[model samples]
Target chain A: MNALSTTVGPPAMSRRGPVSTGPNIPSLVGSEPQQRGMGIARSRLVFVVILFCAAFFVMAARTVELSLKKAEPMQVTKQHVTVPPVQFTRADILDRNGEVLATNLGTSSLYAYPARIRDPEEAARKLVSVLPNLSEGHLIQKLSASKGYIRLQQRLSPRQKWAVNALGIPAFEFAPDEERIYPHGRLAVHALGAVNYKNEGISGAERYFERRLSDAASTNQALRLSIDSRVQYALADELESAMRVFQAIGAAGVVMDVNTGEVIAMVSLPDFDPNTTRGVSGNQRFNRVTQGVYELGSVFKTFTLAAALDDGVVDFSDGYDASLPMKVGGYTIRDDHPKGRYLTVPEIYAYSSNIGTARMALDLGTEQQQRYLSDFGLLRAPDIELVEVGAPLFPARWRKTSTVTISYGHGISVSPLALVTGIASMVNGGRLLPATLIRNSEGWRQGKRVIAPDTSRKIRQLMRMVVTKGTGGRADAVGYRVGGKTGTAEKASNGGYDRKALISSFVGVYPMDDPQYVVFALLDEPKGTKATYGFSSGGWVAAPVVKNVILRTAPLLGVAPKTEDEGLYKNVALRIEE
Target chain B: MRKIVTISAAIAAIMSGVMVLLLNIAVQEQASLNRTLAKQIHDDREAIRILSAEWNYLTTPRTLEDRSGQFLALMPLRAKQIVNTPATIPLRPRGQDVDTKGASSVVLSSADKPRKVKKNQRKGTAL
Candidate 1:
C-alpha cells in the first residue's frame, strides 16, 4: 500500500506543477500528453465564460433600449368581407331629469325579391288587405319591378308583420329593424335633432354623439343631455306663442346655465316633426338658434359697454355725447329712440343708443374692441356639441365705420347661441365656459376668465336698469328680477338695410344678483300690430317672450322669487334720466 | 401481501369510477339549471326595455300637458302659489285653532262643525 501511494503522489504533484505548460516533456509521452489535454480543457472553459458574458451584455443593452424607446404608431389596414351586415341597436337619449327624449322602437319591414316572387299581383293584394296605408297599385308596381329587391312597407306593426307572415307568400320576408322615435314630436326638434330612417343621426345632438349612440355595447346605457324637459317645454311654448302673436317669419330661443354653460332649452320655431322628417321643408329644418347668423342689433350694445368697462376706459357714470347722429366714413349711426341729450354709460346701454355706443367704440378703437369680442368667443364658430353651429360673420377690415356699426350690431352678425354664451360668460363671474350640450362635461373644462368680477357686477346692474326703466322694461318679471337688453336690427337687403324688415331680439338673465341662467329670444321679420302700437321692436316683440319664459321656468329650475325689495340686486343701481 | 394489495387497488378503482360518474351527473344538472336561469334573465331584460319605452311615450310632457288640459282642471303651479317656508303661512285666529294632531279628519269649514244638542231635546228625536 505504501509503495502504491508514494508512486501516485509524486506523479500527481509533478503533473499539477506544469499543467499549463503545453507539450513541454518530449520524452515522457503519456503523462505529458495527458497534461496537455488538461490545459486545452482549461482554455476552453475560459473561452466559454467570455462568450457567455458577451451574449449577456448584448441582451442587457437591447432591454435598456427597448425600455427607453417610444413605440411607433400602429396602422391598421382595412380588409373587407362579404358577410351579412350586423344591424346596430342605438342607445336611448335622456334628459337631465331622466325623461326619455329619444328611444329605439323595434319594428319590422317587409321586403320581397322581385325575381324570386311567383305571383306579384296576388301578393300585393294580400299585403294591401293587411296594411291599409299601402296603395295596392304602388305595392304591385314595387313587387313586380325588374330590380333584385323592393320594399313594400318600411315600418310595419307587429300585428301587420304576423298577418303578412300568415299569408305564406313565397319570396316575401319581414326583416326585423329599429326606428329612432322622438316621443315629444316637435317639442325638442331643434335640440334633439332628427335621424334618417336607417337610424343614422343626421343633425343636432343626435349627430354630435353619433358614435356613442350607435355602439352596440352601450345600448343599455342612455346618453343624458343637460336639458330639462319641463323647462324646454315651457320655453318652446312661450316662444311659439310669441311667434304666433307677433306674426314673425321665424323665432329662436335658448336657455343656458351660467356656470357650467349647459344648454337647458333650445327652441327654433317652424321646426318639423323628427318622427317624419322626410319631405320637410329646408326652412323648417334650419336650426335658427345655432345655425342662423343675424346682426342682433342693440344686444351688441351690451358687449360694447362690457368691453369698454373691462378695458377700464369707461364706468357707469361716464357720459357720452348723443345730441345728434354721429357720422363715420359716409355712414351715419343714430339711436332709434333718439334721446337728444348727452347720456351716461348706463343710459346708453338701457336706451340702446347707437350714437352713444358708436362714440364709446370710437374711444375704445378697433384693436381693443376686436380683442374683447374675440375673447368673448365671438370671432370663431362656437365649439358646441351640435354639428349645426354657425361661424360668426365679421368685417374683413376693422375700419372705423365697421367698428362703429358693429358696436350697434349692424356690420357683424353672429348666431343666437354665440350671443347667449358670450353674455353668460360676462355675467357668470366673468368665466368663459364653452357652451355644452353634454351633462357633467364641466369636469373636463376649467373655464378661461374673460372679465373681472367687479366688471361683471357692474354690467349686471346696468342690465337690470334696462329691464326696470329702459328699452327692456317689458321683460321685467316682478319677482324674478329679469334683467336684459333689447336689440332691433334692420334686415340687410341688396346693398342697404330694409326698414320694414327687422330682426328683434332680447337677452335676459334672471335673479340678477347671482345670475344662474341666460334666456335669449329672437324674432325675424315680425309685423307691426295694434298691441305693439304698430311697433315691431325688440322691447315689444321679444321682451315679452323673455318675461314669459323666465316666469314659467324659474320654478322648475328651483329658483324662488323674491319680494320687490329683495329682488333689487345688491349692487350699485345705475340711476339714469330719460 | 402482493395479492392483498392488488385486491385493494381493484376495489379502490371501482369505487372511484362510481363516484366520478355521480359527480358528472350532478355537474350536468347544475349546468342545465344555469342555462335556464340565463334565458329567463334575458327575457326579463327585453320586457323591461319595451316597458320603459312605453312609459316614456305615455309620460311625454306634450301628451301630459294636453291630457291635463282636457280632463283635469289642474294648471301648472304658479310662483305665488308656492310657499317654501311654514313661516309664510298665515296663522289662525283665536278659537279657530283646531286640534289636528292624531286626528284622521278635521273640519275645514264652519258649516262642517258638529251641532251641539239643546238641554231639553233628546238626540234621537231631532233626526
Candidate 2:
C-alpha cells in the first residue's frame, strides 16, 4: 500500500507541475476564473462599442430626417417661385406746368376661374352686390362660361376689392388693369386730348406726344408746359361770358408769349370734359384754336400791312389810291365803310380799307406775299404741342384775284393759332418762333427772320392807331396801351360771300411800344344784338372781350400800370385827330 | 502616472462638450442673418410701391392748379397781356416812388411790408 501511494503521489505531483506550467493546462485548470474575468472585460468593451454604434446610428438617422425635410421644402419653393415677364406700360400725360393732365393708375379687375365656382348664381349675386354697376345677368353669364378665366368686372376700387376679398371665394382672382384719370374736369379739354379705354392718346397734345409718354425706353418723366392755370382760367371765363353775351355758336381765344412763343392760355368754347368722353359731339371736341380754319376777317389786314411795310412797298407815310373802288379780275374790292379817297398807310390800317390793302398786296407781288405768309407760319401748320393743327386754306394757284381777296382777309382761311403766331412774329421784332406748349428750359428757338425791327415798330404803331382811333376803339384798355385790329369777313356760301353770316375776330398786342403778348379772339357766326346796335363786327363782338381780358390780367402778371409819360407809350400811340 | 492620465482625459471630455456648444451657436447666427435679409427685401418692395403712388397723387392737374392759384395769386393770361422781353423792363420804385404812388396802388400796406419774395416766384419769373 505504501509503494502504491508513493507511485500515485509522484505521478500527481508531476502532473500538477506540468499543469501549472503548460499554456492550455493553466487556462483549463483556471478556466472558470479566467472565463469570468474575460467575460466581464469582453462584456464591458462590447457595451462601449455598442453604445458608440448606437450614437452614430442615431446621429446618421437624425441627419437623414433633417435633410429629407429640407429637400421637400426646397422643392416646393422652386415650384412656387414664378418669374413674371417684363413689359412696358403707357406714360403719363401732363399739363404745361408739370401738372398731371392724364395718368394711368393701377386697378385690379376681378375675374373668376369658371370651373372652380361651386355655385354660379350665388357667386354672381355676391359680385353684383359689391359692384352695383355690374348687372347680375352679366356676372352670371361670365361665371358660367366654359373659358378658363372670365372677367366679372373691370377697374374695381380698393373698397370694392376688399369687399370681394372678404367673401374669400377660392376661384376669384384679381387681374391688374391700368385706368386713366383726368383731374382738371373740363379745363383745357381741347388741348389735353382724349384717350381710349386702354389709355392710348387719340387726339390733341396727348396724341402728339404719345410715344414720349408711352415708351418706357425713352422716359417716364412728366411733361412740363408753358400754360399758367390762372391765365387759362381767366381767358376761358371772359371768352365764355362773351360767347353768351354775343349769342354766338362758338368762340375761340389764344394767349401766347411773344418772345418765348409759349401758349399761356388757349380756350375753345363748348368744350367737353375729358374724364367723361361719351355723349360729346364732334364739334365739342374740336380744338378751334388749332384746328378750325376760318377767314378771320380784317385781322388779316395787320399781316397784309406788315408784309407791305417789311417789303418796303409801303412806309409809315406812304399813300395808296383808296378814292376809287379797285376792281381786280371780276371781283370788286370795297371796304364796308368806303372812304372813296386816297389814304396813307396808317389810314389804310386805321380805316381798314380793302381797296388800299389790295393795292398794297399787288405792289408787293405774289412772291413777296408768299414769302411773308410762309414766314408768318401761315403756309404750313403752326408748330404746337397738339396734333390738331390745321393748314391754311389758301389758293394753290396764287393768282391776281386770290392775292387781291387775301389782302383784306377773304380768300385765305387759317386757324386761330396760325393768325396768332403770325401776329406774334410781326410784333415780336421779326423773329418767327414756333409756338410751344411745353415749358422749355431754353425758351422758343429763334426762327427765320421775317421782318425788320423798324417794320415791327411801325406795325405796332399802326395796330395802336386802329385801337385808339378806328374799329378797335372799344378794345382800348386804359393804362395798358392795348393795340389791335378788327376783322369782320363775310362767310362764303356756294362760292359767294354771305350777307348774313360773318366771322368776326380781333388780334391785339399789349404795351405796343415794346410789344410782349399777342391775344386773338374770334366769334364764329355771331349774330347782331341790341347792345351791338345790330352790328357783329370784330369791334362790336371780339374787341370788348380782349379789352377786359388785358385789363384784368396785366396786374396779375406783375405789369405795372403805365403812366402817360412812360416811354413804353411814347412812340406807339398815334395822335388822334379831333 | 495613472492619476496624470485620468486628469488629461477629463480635460479632453470638457473641451469636446464646449466645441459642440460653439457649433450650435454658429448655426443659429447663420439662420438669423438669412431672416433679417429677407425682411429687408420685403420692406424695400413696400417702400417702392408707396412712393410711386404718392408721386402720381402730387402731380394731378386739379390739385396743382388749386395750389398754384392759392400760392401765386395768378389770373388767366391773354395774348395781349404777353409780349417779347420788353426792350426794357420797368423798375419798381424805391422809397420816394412808392410814397408818390397812392397806398392803394401798392399791393402791401405799412402793416404788411413786402417780405422776401419766395424762391418759386423768382424761378417762375426767370423762366
User: TM-score of predicted model 1?
Assistant: 0.78
lDDT of 1 by residue, A124-177 (tens): 898788888889898788888776877777788788888988988877888877
Instruction: Give the per-residue lDDT of model 2 (tens digit) for A471-521.
Output: 899898877888899999888999788987888889999877667788888
Predicted model with the maximum TM-score = 1
Worst 10 residues of 1 chain A by lDDT: A78-87
User: Where in model 1 is the C-alpha error above 4 Å?
Assistant: A1-88, A113-118, A133-151, A168-171, A441-445, A564-574, B1-37, B92-94, B97-127
Residue ranges of candidate 2 with Cα displaced over 4 Å: A1-88, A166-170, A564-578, B1-127
lDDT per residue (tens digit) for residues B8-76 in model 2 = 868877898899989889867866766666666656654544455466456444466578898998865
Every model: Cα RMSD to truth: 16.2, 12.5
**Chain B, TM-score, each prediction?**
0.54, 0.43
